[model samples]
Target chain A: MKKLIFIFVLLIFSFSYAYQFYGIPYLQQVNDFSLINQDGKKIKFSDFKGKYLLVFFGYTYCPDVCPTSMLRISDVLDELGDYKKYVKVLFISVDPERDTPKALKKFISFYDKTGKYIVGLTGKPEDIKKVAKQFRAFYQKVPVKNKEVGYLVDHSAYIYLVDPKGIIRMIYRPDNDDPKRIAEDIKQIIKMFGTGE
Target chain B: MKKFIIFLLTGFIFLAYGNEIIIKDPWIRAVPPSSKNTALFMTIVNKSDKQDTLISVKTDIAKIVMIHKTVEENGIMKMKHVDSLSIPPHSEVKLKPGGLHIMIMGLKRPIKEGEEVKINLFFKNSGNIEILAPVLRR
Candidate 1:
């Protein structure tokens, strides 16, 4: 009886460990909020209802991780190919004080010159804080000794994949997740959810 | 004639005992027209028997340049300033994306793709080395 029980426990643990999605499964309905986009237009969470939303929290001043994440996202979109039409990438700035709409526009244009695929968003600090809390994203401004650079913002760099129905379905580490795998995951989610269109 | 011979001999000796630090594939991240910051990536190989430390970096494209390392703790990515990076003897140190990098801030002008930028790197024992790095998106 003890041997049988141990076997059953091991099977249960293995079953639980096996996840369906390539990214970490995070199934929840994301709260809706409003923030200003790079075009200086107020965009609400509901505005992206019919498309899969790839949300990332970062700042424009981030030279290493932020740009790397952006490039990864661009590659993922490229991998999506025809499916890219049903997806949108959102880069939310945690440092709203320095990331004005104009600055955000210029920074995002570097990745997407047409400015049609990726959207850079920034708003009031408290409003950004609320939105960050909704996604459980953390960011803090740490002052540096250098007078020219002023300060740096340390932030979480996870890419959240929200389904077309406004439900958070998966999360990816920008530094670790492969673009092809992420693209396949998005396709799987689309096939299962029917794009919610 | 004696002084000339001595000078030539000293020149030959100095050439034979010079620093053996080699830099490869150095490139700077290209930024948008209005952006003010970028990062540089490269691989430094020290062929000499003695270790050397990279002390400072200077560039005319940006007002401030510093060595920074991107560290991830508790799922948060943070950039930390590194005073110097030491390259071990007969080993190579990489400064790449999502790792060690040279952070350049307060750009005097936009760095577009396909352009070349000159940078001066000062080493503890290797002295000053100049490199022209191409601006690339990667």
Candidate 2:
């Protein structure tokens, strides 16, 4: 009985420690959504099963925040090294009007030219809105004064870490989180809960 | 007499080149092929006694060059066009990623890594200063 009580205490401690993640802990199943990938092929969220997804919402036209986040995500993938095969980065465009499949392909190629790891997704405005709602991501178009540059899109820059089972396990703010720490957390998650593979 | 003449030449050189606005670590973010846009970042140092304002930027590679600042509110990121950036005397202004940057749009061609982009920065006090910013990923 004493050994059983000691074992129970140890398990509780381990569970609590395991839950500590560098990003915000969010252990809820993600809602599935369909969108068009960079190749103009239809893709569903469930299709990424058995692999972790690093998802963020932005537009290709955004020269500042989007590229910064993309670079950070690339660094995170670099930090993963050999384990990057088990991880995938998803860049969902909120500006459907300008972010067509071809444009997305051009944008993502700067980060991942081979197109094996990083995937850019876009769809109709309504469909994009629906997916953004599912992930609680906010985005809106704001018209600018410049004629050559018609408008800009404002978006939330939270990077969601979805597990292999389509569950969002962590949230990272690129402004605050380091890529190395984010990669470490993903590795910890994979160790704690086997990569569903 | 030789020492005095050398001292005078050095003073003349300082008078001609010293106290000018200095640009450090100027670079353009390298984008993919067929990309229409990218951003430039650098640190503007003002050593003069008067404040200077960066009124406009011009580049031949892009159709439009605008000063833009990324503002974050309630976790939302928005890029706002800045008419001018003011650099105080004896201080430095950093235009970096996720903050103030020079937005270059409508690129004529892909700016690959290791390439240099010539840009002209017009300042209120310093007039136009030309620089060649290297294209880089960081």
DockQ winner among the candidates? 1
Clashes of 2: 0
* Fraction of true A-B contacts recovered by candidate 2: 0.69
TM-score of each: 0.89, 0.89
Give the 10-residue window scoring lowest on summed lDDT in candidate 2 chain A: A4-13
| Poorly placed runs, candidate 2 (over 4 Å) | A1-20, B1-19
Per-residue lDDT tens digits for candidate 2, residues A153-188, read 889999999989887877887586588989988888
Q: Model 2's lDDT to the true fold?
A: 0.87
Clashing pairs in 1: none
Mind giving the per-residue lDDT tens digits that candidate 1 earns over B1-138?
999999999887665445789999999987677877889999999987788899999999999999999998888988888999999988999999888999998899888899999999999988999999999976
Model 2 CA lDDT for position A143: 82
lDDT of 1 by residue, A2-65 (tens): 7754664454345446535578767667878999998899999899999999999988888888
- The per-residue C-alpha lDDT of model 1 at residue B33 equals 74
- All candidates: interface RMSD: 1.2, 1.4
